[model samples]
Target: MARGPAATPNPTVAARDGMVLPAAGPGTGTPLAVRGLTVSYGENPAVFSVDADFPPAAMSAIVGPNGAGKSTFLKASLGVIPRLAGEVDVFGKPVEQARARIAYVPQRASVDWDFPTTVIDVVKMGLYREVGLLGRLSGARSTRAMRCLDRVGMADFAHRQIGQLSGGQQQRVFLARALAQDADLYLLDEPFAGVDAATERAIIDVLRDLKAEGRAIVAVHHDLSTVPAYFDHVFLINVRRIAEGPVATTFTPETLQATYGGRLAATHLDELAITGGA
Candidate 1:
């Protein structure tokens, strides 16, 4: 595959509040690939010289400690944030060319729950690229949005105010919005954070279904215990790529220690059944 130029600050992406989409396309090659990716904020770089690949038809997790730049890497790879230097490709093409096939679910904390909008209306936003920002949601589009909400088990809450829902409900609404896009690759930042076990299971089940249908699911996940069970591919990082590959091989005790540094204790490792200490 050909390498693309380093991603720069994209005012269009920034202007859209980091949610932009184009017409969907039939993607080819790897789902996502980044080489020498670097992102800086102030004197220090949040992510530095990282290289990684997320395969198609699999659920992959980017795991690391707090402040490890896991989110930064995801944002930069998608050009949601500016990259100092790196090449990012989606399905063998530049990310810019493949925006249509990508969908992003940002952290729930980053969203303003206070926003005055209905759950169904929020999901309808995902169809903006198809229906135009000001275009009215026709019956078909509205029905599609409702179906997405139904898939996330939020159909009953469709008319409810977004702020009026619980944290887990809010997360499910966002996931429904992403699902409305019907993209080939889903980039989720902490989809399981702050959600109840039922919601987590619901979200993972939906994601696994997407994978079964040949879509890619890449998420920035924090829970180490669920990594092995929920994800087939794991990318361990600490501001840089630590280890990446199948969960069985790359998510070992040694890599966990390296990725988390001293933050991962021996008891935690034993609990994870990795058979080693930090």
Candidate 2:
């Protein structure tokens, strides 16, 4: 999972597939793309003129140090943040036109874990589009939601109150909600941030399954160590587009130094971890 070089914002291939998974049927080479994207708060710009393309049926990791605008970029793509001057397209359509095919798993801190909701209620909430306004539930909806819970190993906890679950279990419930969405593109912000190794592996497996099915999965990741092994592509961002490409090339020490500045040196341990070393 350790990376090699650093370069301009472009994409490359790593670990091509021989037998394609049924979920991903050779998605339209370019499923998501952005040009001159910028997001800001009040008078400050979080992202600036960044342009990048994400391939269909691939796993793309959006990475950077704190305040690097990785999550902002994802939000921008989804139209959550205000864009200065840019365009976002999904599955060959403008973002708004393709909203139904998009799913989002915000950072854990963004959710109200103590909202007094049951696991089944939370998972079923994701079926909003299918349920329309009345919030009605059919036998099929319940069945699918249960299957999604099972996929995340949460079927046993299906009836438990979400507030009582552990941090990792809460994260899995969010993932299960996204799974219930059954969309084409998934945007996850720090799904592994506070998770244990086992939860991380379980989340990774879910992501792998999504990519295999040809669903584009983009995660805003802070752990530089796991990018190489877990993602096919990465966008090394920091207020500006630092580098974008395969993890093998975009995650070099030079790039890390550029984005993290003084903190780059602190990541020596990260470099070692990426390379299978101590």
Candidate 3:
């Protein structure tokens, strides 16, 4: 266990504008690799030198405190937010070149629930990247969308307006949308935030299914207790990479304190499990 902080920038990672990134090795079995990734808001760096590899067919959690750049790292990796430095690779290829293989679900709060869109309509939006904006959703595509909704246990809500549903329902709708994308990798920000216990279980079931199918699922998770139960890997970040690897070994109390400071005393593994139904 290499403790403390991440090592100095590896020479293998190429330099871009003075930002050194970790190079993707051949046959590393990792779908995603980030090297020396740095993102800044004006002069303040949101994410400093970070490096990690996300294995294929696994669930990984990005854990950190507020303002720890969890969301910033996700956006920067997807190129939705411009990174001040570093590089991101998907399947050993640049993110831009592998765009179609990735799917993203932003925070529920970040979306406007008031948007006059049906549940099915929102799921269909996932196909827009593949089918194009003007492309029509034929009977086949519409059926596919319905199947995705069914996966998230929201088939009955397909006709309901997004805003009319409860918070948990809304989150399921977004998960269904990501499922419709049919991408190789999924990046979700706070998928369980503000959702009921039922919704949390439903989402976790779907994510586990995705991992079973040889796809990668990376999520920004806040609950420390459930992390060990939910994910196979943990990537801890606090402005910089604190520790990243298997949850059992890397997600230690020491790393948690290093990432969240002294206030994380309550992040224990024996708390009440929310994986049960509501």
lDDT of 2 by residue, 1-278 (tens): 54553542233444456654223223344668898998888688999999988877889988888988898898888998778878998876788988778889988889788898899889998898788899679999999999999999899999998999999999999999999999899989999989888899999999999999979998899887777788888888888998888777766777777877887665584664457232
Candidate 1 TM-score over all chains jointly: 0.88
Q: Write the per-residue lDDT of candidate 1 for residues 1-278, one digit (tens) a residue.
A: 54333432222222356765432234557899999999999889999999999999999999999999999999999999999999999987899988878999999999788898899999999897787757777999999999999999999999998889998999999999999999999999999999998999999999999999999999999998888888999998898889999988788888888888888998897788642112
Runs of candidate 2 exceeding 4 Å displacement: 1-29, 266-278
| Model 1 error, position 225 (Å) | 0.4
Q: How many residue pairs of model 3 clash at the backbone?
A: 1
TM-score of each: 0.88, 0.86, 0.85
lDDT of 3 by residue, 1-278 (tens): 55333553332554878876556543223688899999999788999988978888999999999999999999999999999889899988899988778889999999899999899999999888778867777899999999999999999999998999999999999999999999999999999999999999999999999999989999999988788789999999999999999887788767777898865655342232223111
Ranking by lDDT: 1, 3, 2
Please tell me which model should have the higher TM-score, number 1 or number 3.
1
> In angstroms, how far off is 163's CA in candidate 2?
0.7
Stretches of candidate 1 above 4 Å error? 1-26, 274-278
RMSD of each: 9.7, 9.0, 9.6
Flag regions of model 3 displaced more than 4 Å.
1-29, 266-278
Ranking by TM-score: 1, 2, 3
